[model samples]
Target: MAYQVIIIEDDPMVAAIDRQYVETDSRFQVAHVLKSGGEALGVLENCRPDLIILDFYTPSMDGMEFVDRLHAMGQYPAIIMVTSANDREIVHGLLSRGVLDYLVKPFAFARFRQAMDKFLQTQNLLSCSQESSLLDQQAIDRLIRRQERPEPGGNQMSKGLNAATLERVRSFLSASRGQALTSEEIAEQVHLSRITIRRYVNYMVETGELASSIDYHTGGRPSIRYSYTGQTAEP
Candidate 1:
């Protein structure tokens, strides 16, 4: 079953965008879109969502008050803050209260995707711990290290290249197998901007994770197509 998510943003447009980003990953579903924390609190017990995308400022109740109320009610859903508020005090307070991730307003889709990936990773680790009843040192370390870390590619990724986004592109190309696709095509499939997709594809090609070829059938300047190389880069 897909994990349920609730979005709490007073702005309708931002709420729609949050829903779009959340639904891009097949593993999650938006369970509710509420305008304020007061409305959210009304349904939290019944909905019991796994995650929430929240804005700091709202009409009835602010983000901090919402969090405090949740704690008082003994409900602790994972939260990813997406708001214009960048005050250091607000951020520090939310972090101390265990918000899973924070994104300032005007953030890119890649950054949003990264936050969702982190939440999923944490959920997976928690599930494993529940089944085993005991976690090894490595497992504990992974849970504690919430910050983004380079994966698959042992070296740090280049600027603007996110590991989660790169993996999404790689996964799509790998599934395509025999067919190679241009950046635009891949972007459409993966719900990422073409330029972002192109950057990742180029990085993957350099790392030997993808192979590229020129396609001249368009009757204009030849376009480059990428395919998974069937080889994993050595760390």
Candidate 2:
């Protein structure tokens, strides 16, 4: 089925670009595009979308505040914050709150595609599951806690991570909560090199953090799915 999406952006140009990107493929569609969060609210009541691309800043209501209101009302939508802001804290904060993914502003169409693709893949993984997630304190903590790794030489990295490349990869596996992904897919979401991603996936499999299954009928190596045993990825 085609994924329905909404764009909540203040800039007409940016919103237009986003709409075009969402409708570029038949697998995705833009249900509605609005300039402010309040406009989004009424329109959304009548039309629901699978995902919402939110701008952090708008004239009427900002993205974060809108998200807070949505949560208060027990409404949840897989959201991707599409903002020009470079505030690392805000970026990580929203991500830690169970956002499907985060994208900095002024991004290329290719990057935008990667973000949506990864999110849909994650959604697919979520849909295939039959079990329910508990919302206990521990579960909430795991969902929001910092999971980035530190770079070598003890210096801070471009993105927040606390360990070496492989260690960070291991952390993602243990934290995935049982999601399967390809190396390229993981790399896109994590902001890492594809080669580095493959190395980490391989390491995880060797260490038993991930198990590989073959696509014998399809060809090539079997796709590996990792079951995160530590905490629930859901918040």
Candidate 3:
């Protein structure tokens, strides 16, 4: 089950690097490398790769516009936005447009591998369904599409935390190391609801894994803030 990949980037040099990465993985094949949205539209209808690596900045039409056009043509290749834009708005924009996930630019090889592996995990679950294999929906859903599962050797599951929640919490904590982030800030960073984040934070604090403090510096009354203690074992 080799998945074909298409790279659409304006930068030829960067596109070549992405091609190299795709080729290194046995499960993925670089199907095409195109520059602009127009060029992509030219052959995409014919190429129909399993996944598309899109760049945000491109000449002519941009990635989002091209994705819109692609969907209009009844095409839905799993999209992963690979760009230098680390802005939360950009990440939310892609998610709002139904992108599978996104990867920020200047990523290390390990991070790149993580992104690709997560896509493959989702593909694995879908392939099983296509094969007519009977699967428990909850179990499969829990196991499927885990884009950030921690290394199992850590054994942090004993605290009753699964990979999804653990990864979400970890990323939030990592991004909030220097400053205390409000519940809303944590939610936005983790792409979870503020209520849901509170629940997770409460759990971690109850387990003595996270630290929370009262903040009055931002005005509008004082509010509680949550952050990881940086002492919890990475699981």
Candidate 4:
């Protein structure tokens, strides 16, 4: 079943965009697109959504106040803030309140996908923990050290490579384990260009995150295919 999502944005265009981005991933479906935080809060009273795409500046209640109200009501859903607000105080407040991810306006689709991927990963981990009733040290560590964007000079990522895009590719390939995929196949699913996906796959191959093989059965030039190696890449 796909996870249910609710979007709270005042602008119709932005709300539509958020819905489009959220639904792009097969794991999530937008359950509602509310224009005000107050309306959203009322809706949350009965149903608990898996995630929420929220804007900081909305009628009825601002994002911060909305978060506070949700906490007061003992309702905690994964939240990804998609707003134009770049104030450090607002960001810090939202982060302190445990907002899963924040994206300033004019962000790329890659960044949006990265946030969704993060929420899905966290949900998966939580589900595992619930089933096991216990978490190992590594599992605990992974839960605590949620993936974040690398610093500008961070050597963890190669130059000219985006951490978010790399994660998207890695997550998709991981899901398709046991099946080798060409760059074009991956690009089509991830909504990225074939050339861009090829670059990322090459980097993953070099870093040992993916195994590459040649497929000569295409009746023409042999094409390269990549499969996840079941190895976790350094964050």
Candidate 5:
């Protein structure tokens, strides 16, 4: 069965992009696209989706308030924030409130796909029997924990790099958070050669998974630093 999704974004273009990105995965479908949190609340009177692609700033009531009301009414579905807001407090608060994932604006298709893939994995585990074995419980626990820590490996593979190793490099940078890392630094952590790491880094930079910056010094050649941007590459 396809996962039902509701999108609450004020911008029509962004909403359309969100819908398009999710539709690329056959496992998901958008059931409704409302312009504001208020409209979404009204629509929920008749429909309930498996997930909600929400923006932080919406008309009537913003995304945070909408979530507050949802919790007050005891309605919780997996939520992934697709907004331009980058305040650290807001991100931390949403995570604390059990939001599934957060995607900033101008994100690549892969980032959106990453969140949907996670939701699918969680849904699969949840579809199992409630009285399942201890092993099943352990697996679910691990999956939940994986969300808090970025683990490398995605379905998307670029040339000369497999998904597994690509993710390993990604995971290393993600673990570092906003810290600026170079190809040499990442190579050491992922245990790959600099040349190989550079290729992967270049690919990620192009794909929007990572952001690169140039560092100039007094006496040495300029160095490049890469940071995980929490966004995906273009489709």
Candidate 6:
């Protein structure tokens, strides 16, 4: 079954890009593209969407207010917030109010695809037969986790490092162009540990999406600096 998706974003370009992204997946359909919370609220009253891709800032009303109104109307659908806002307090509040996932602005297609796939996985789990075992319940819990999952080909799942997150780190660096970033710096931006980021950076360098150079110091240990190669990072 194709999942219905509603996108509420004000910027025409961003909305268009989002719609294009949704079109790439056959399992999802773009049901509506409203520019404001008020417009979405009206249409969503009768439209039963399985998911909503929301923007934080909008005319007429904002995403937060729209969510509040949806709750008031008792319309509960999974929400994936796409916005430039990175305020921790706002994110905490939104998660508390039932947001399924959060994606910062300027994210690449890989990250977006990962989010959609994970949501689909959750939906599939929810539709499982009622005679579910404890193992099935555990699997469902893992699927419902907000974190990205490793690609099937990778054997490093034990590290909690996923291909999507690795691509995210690569995409972030690609956006930086020629700037050299340390593992610590990348970790800070990507919200991963220094070790995890370092592993991904090395893997990217091996795969040729990025190149690494040694930064020598007088007495300290030489540091590795990573730069984007202006190529696709897909393995």
Candidate with the larger lDDT of 3 and 6: 6
lDDT string, candidate 3, 41-93, tens digits: 99986878899889888778877788889999999998888888777877777
List candidate 5 stretches off by more than 4 Å.
130-137, 147-235
Which pairs of residues clash in candidate 1, taking residues 3 or more apart in a chain or in different chains? none
Per-residue lDDT of candidate 1, residues 74-95 (tens digit) = 8898999999999999999999
C-alpha TM-scores of all predictions: 0.67, 0.54, 0.60, 0.64, 0.61, 0.63
What's the residue-level lDDT of 106 in candidate 6?
Answer: 77
Report residue 202 deviation for candidate 6 (angstroms).
Answer: 23
How close to the true structure is residue 141 of candidate 1, measured as C-alpha lDDT? Answer: 92
The list of candidate 6 runs beyond 4 A from truth reads 130-136, 143-148, 151-235
Clashing residue pairs in candidate 2 are 148-161, 148-162, 149-161, 149-162, 149-163, 150-161, 150-162, 150-163, 178-227, 178-228
Ranking of candidates on TM-score, top first: 1, 4, 6, 5, 3, 2
Lowest-scoring 10 consecutive residues by lDDT in candidate 4? 147-156
lDDT pick, better of 1 and 6: 1
Which residue runs does candidate 2 get wrong by more than 4 Å? 129-235
Native-to-model Cα distance after best TM-score fit, residue 130 in candidate 3, in Å: 4.6
Worst 10-residue lDDT window, candidate 3:
147-156
Which ten contiguous residues of candidate 1 have the minimum total lDDT? Answer: 147-156
State each model's C-alpha RMSD to the native: 9.6, 14.5, 14.0, 11.7, 11.8, 12.5
Please give, for residues 69-121, the per-residue lDDT of candidate 6 as tens digits.
99899899999999998898889888888888889997755567667766876
lDDT of each: 0.81, 0.64, 0.71, 0.81, 0.77, 0.77
Error of 5 at 87 (Å): 0.8
Per residue, candidate 5 scores C-alpha lDDT tens digits across 98-207 of 89999998776556656776787777666656685444657768676755313355444524477788888878888898798877888888889877787677667656
